[model samples]
Target: MRILLAYDGSPAAETALGLAISRYGDDELVALYVAEVDPTTYDASAFGGGTDDVPDSDEAEAVLEEARERAVQEGYELETAVEQGSPSDVIAEYADEHGFDQIVMGTHGRQSISEVIVGSTAEQVVRNSPVPVLTVR
Candidate 1:
């Protein structure tokens, strides 16, 4: 299926990942993590606080690694990417640029934040994607 999974390492995103793993065949998956360069997080040397340690890039890498491991364990061919930018934009770009057939992702479950589609990444991706996006809670 050449699918892309947008993971944020959140419990919600993880649940979506679990669903995706169970639904697709091993040969039809590609996992992705977007760095989500948040302007609020911009700093010259912000890499030393545990509470503030979850930089989008690092978080993205961690999630992608987990997704790839899952795919490998399930015998699926896996590809990974880490790009810097908005989550929705990056996911859409990756899917389009890589010729993905579908996108599977998890949302944060924030149901009122319009700026972020209920404050969830999944919502934003679904709203901004050119291709079909399957959102898992």
Candidate 2:
């Protein structure tokens, strides 16, 4: 089975990564890190105000590298990908485009007003994903 693992270097993501490695060690695992670009940044750039604070691919790569190392420590090799977009959108689209059989991700378990305003990435992915999603907290 092909599994898309959403990794963001968070503690919850670490837990998910370890779970995926242990439970689906024989499956094809791809660690995906989505570099979320703020839409306002793009809008500002379009209006001639270039922002240096935009999330870069390098940051995404670094997180994916960490995921790879963790997988290695667990005796598994992981393929890594870095994508630019909203985390949930990127994850769901990548899983569909790559024909992944399942998606494994972490839930931040945020229960604050900010969570209500911005919604949880895990919840959004679970609602939008074409394939089954296994979320770890």
Top candidate by lDDT: 2
lDDT of each: 0.69, 0.83
What tens-digit string does per-residue lDDT give for candidate 1 at 1-137? 68787776677777877777888756467766655456676542465533234455566666678877876787765677666656777888888888888898876632335545334666667777888998876
Each candidate structure's TM-score, on Cα atoms with residue i matched to residue i, is 0.71, 0.83
Model 2: how large is the Cα RMSD against the reference?
Answer: 4.0
Candidate 2 achieves a global lDDT of: 0.83
- Candidate 2's displacement at residue 9, Å, is 0.3
Residue 36, model 1: Cα distance from true site in angstroms: 1.7
| Residues 55-99, model 2: lDDT tens digits | 576777777888888888888999988766678888999999999
